[model samples]
Target: MSGAARQSVSSALPRSVDVAKVAGVSQKTVSRVLNDEPYVSDEVRRRVLEAAEQLGYRLNSAARALASGRTRSIGVVTLGTALFGPASLLMGVERAVRDTGYALRVVNTMEGDTAGIAGAVESLLEQGVDGIVISEPIDEGEVPVRVDVPVLVIGAPAPFAAPHVVTAGVGAGVLASAATDHLLDLGHHTVHHLAGPQRWYAARDRLAGWRTALAARGRPQPPVVEGDWSAASGYSAGRDLAANPALTAVFAANDDMAIGLIRALTEAGRRVPDEVSVVGFDDVPVAAYITPPLTTVRQPFDAVAREGLEMLVHAIEHPLAQPSPAIDPPVELIVRASTSPPPGKPREPSGSTTSYQA
Candidate 1:
């Protein structure tokens, strides 16, 4: 048969036997290359890999798992919302998992109680996930869960004994403090906060940060406007904030709320950064293009995911003591048009022409 005919006639579902034949090596050698076992000579390893690639061979995950007693799959648990923070964090995590050569499985749960979270974990475990990552952990308001497999909890600390990886970049406390301090530094006498749900660790930490900033500077605390991390809730909170003439600065837990708050403030005839300065968190992509580009705190979701996945893999492999990994990524502040000194204070540049008031 012609070489082309031979290639075409080859089994589409290529196996280690086919790779061995093509590479002039034993099936054992091909298995070693697939498993990345040491002591395989470089030339032989290269030949085996080339043959595998040429034949479109894929290692059977189930067979490999059976042999090694590990599924070679990573699982993730997250809220079912399309919220930018969780969504972005998940993207980063998936990338990291793919890079680490593991199949990714995900389970989404409703944000009601710890039972939902527990259920998701159980589902992943049943599927035989070698490791698991919880992207957004709530207080869950239940007893801690015990996970036998290596686990990593993002955003909030792990409820049970496992490695907790804080998304590097911005912490709730850090962002809230920075946002409040920025407004105060710009001459806003006091700052009001539109807080996210108290059940969320992010929300509680942000609220604490705002309170800390205010108390440290001896500024009186205004009644907080509660929000569900939604634009609608922020709008509702903003209306309340707008009615109070004493309020000149506001810190929102996230950009979505900030956008809604800005809309409400504008409708109420309160000029943002002129009559009121607003700062938000997450620095969502559209934040810079909003009516008045939002001055916000940025979270490095991609970096956090990469770092987190690394930590998880390390835990899975080592299962013992090793050098500690950095838990949080450095937070960043993006100065934009939405923030400035309150009206009549020394006019600080907002760096953008989009007027929050206009």
Candidate 2:
């Protein structure tokens, strides 16, 4: 308990310094206890709570803004769709911001709105936010965003550049390479790809990763089957792929598409992991329960959020400090029944493929 490390580090509200003094703890400790962040012991938490209550140290975003040049609130511009990747990344941001004692202001952008992100940023600036998070942005050629505040662009390329703009990635290409290599290591001749739409940076990264893995192994690359990140599109792609007698493995962009592909393959008389092996990205909750549980790459949503926010808040607080070098989020590929060696070939536990090329 006491040995546990603080998962997130954030600045303390100015008024919180008094509570820290009264509780005989550092400002960071006070912030942790107040924000319900983990790692503090029960005794320290109780003491901090008691001191805060006695001093009436309530959180006031406006007061914090006046005192620290920060609203203590963050604005996020994200896609409004209920798709798994965007929704999950948004949820991770919500948790990370709250852990840092920061209030959240959100602006949802429709999928095809030309001015969505630019307009959303303007709206958030009208209110007031210390920093901004641009999550899962699609490739819109050129974006007209020129904000002065520190910006954290996650899982996508930065739309605009500025001294304070910080870009962090989800390592989607690396994760996709892992999924593709899993199939290649399973003794498949060549792994086929079920790609997401090219407009999305995430999908493009995954597609690039798949290509990298194939190239690394000197394997023949098949034409990609593009999906709209939906089950229907995957089903259609699956029907197309099932027609090829040499198809033995498929790497899907996400779990939804993977599931639909499985259905199509099943109906087409090709059994999963027997006639054809499948690997997916995003490792959704139901992936394990599905028939022939899916083998997939699990994205580190929480890790990426926490790491990106940490750098952003640092940039916001110390405008003159050198930007911290970003470390890639940890990537993990969950192995399951859907992937195995080619039919009549023995399975090997060692996926001793060389490191990811991209």
Candidate 3:
């Protein structure tokens, strides 16, 4: 048949059968190539892909799921907020999923909904997702008795025996300690804290890390001012912190709060680093652009997502095999201009004594 005649007969949305015919291969071979099944020769796989591309053929995911009993898709559930942590984690997961040739589905949940986590899971399952990922689980008090599929939780531990992954928040204790120690090493008498809401696991972990570092150095732990992970909250906390002349350094739970705190302190006639050094968690995108670019802890979100995808993929591929244990990625502290030695103090020499008096 002539090429024009064949084109006229082809469906606008080409199918596997059309690709097989064009490539002069069996429909099963087309399936194997589409699904990345092993044993197909390189030449055959290349021919199949080229044919599919030329014919504008797209794999029918639903039909493939029916035949293989797997959807080749993963679902993610996260809070319905524009918070930096959850949003960045989601983006990272998406990049990893696409790289692995899997489809993604995401669901966002609100607080205080009676149908919270359970409802989100049901919706994903109904859509035939092979596995589910809870990106950030708040303390909702609802644990699944048993999910028939693999599940991975980020930030908080899974309520059941499912696998989990840790973002920066998991190691917040150590991260906070490191940030505090940096300020202390700069000759600050004592570092104050601007904490996130107490209800959040991230906030709590960060607070604990800060406390642990302070206690280790015999420095007094100041009262924690709570913020709602908003710049406004940080500003309010900053105001309270600025009033206290004793506070020479501040560690905010996240960058937003840090920004607010800095603004408030600046308005109060206090110079950052010169008067009060500030450090924040979550090296957000805008951290460097702001004046005196924020010195903060950078979460390895890409690493966390890549790890979570690896675990979930393993569980999906081997339902009966045991999944790997949760792993915590290492976090980095980016020292910027926002922090420095307190006024009237020179840089401390190695093994020098740290004076607690302001």
The digit string of per-residue lDDT tens for model 3 on 75-94 reads: 88888888998788889989
Rank order by TM-score, top first? 2, 1, 3
Model 2, span 159-179: residue lDDT tens: 765447676777888899888
Pairs of residues clashing in candidate 3: 173-209
Residue 217 shift from truth in candidate 3, angstroms: 1.8
**Model 1, 1-358: lDDT tens per residue?**
0000000011135568999999999999999999899989999999999998887565644445656678789899988878888888888889999999889999998877678787787677667777788766467764344455667767675554433232232356766787788788888889999999998878888899999999999999988888999999999998888999888889999999999999999999999878888999988889989988999987667866787777777766665545244655555778898888877768866663221100
Candidate 1 minimal-lDDT segment of 10 residues: 1-10
1 versus 3: better TM-score goes to:
1
* Structural similarity to truth (TM-score) of each candidate: 0.75, 0.78, 0.74
Q: Report lDDT (CA) for all predictions.
A: 0.77, 0.81, 0.75
The numbered model that scores best in TM-score is 2
C-alpha-based local distance difference test score of model 3: 0.75
Instruction: Tell me the spans in candidate 3 whose CA falls farther than 4 Å from its real position.
Output: 1-67, 144-146, 160-170, 324-328, 347-358
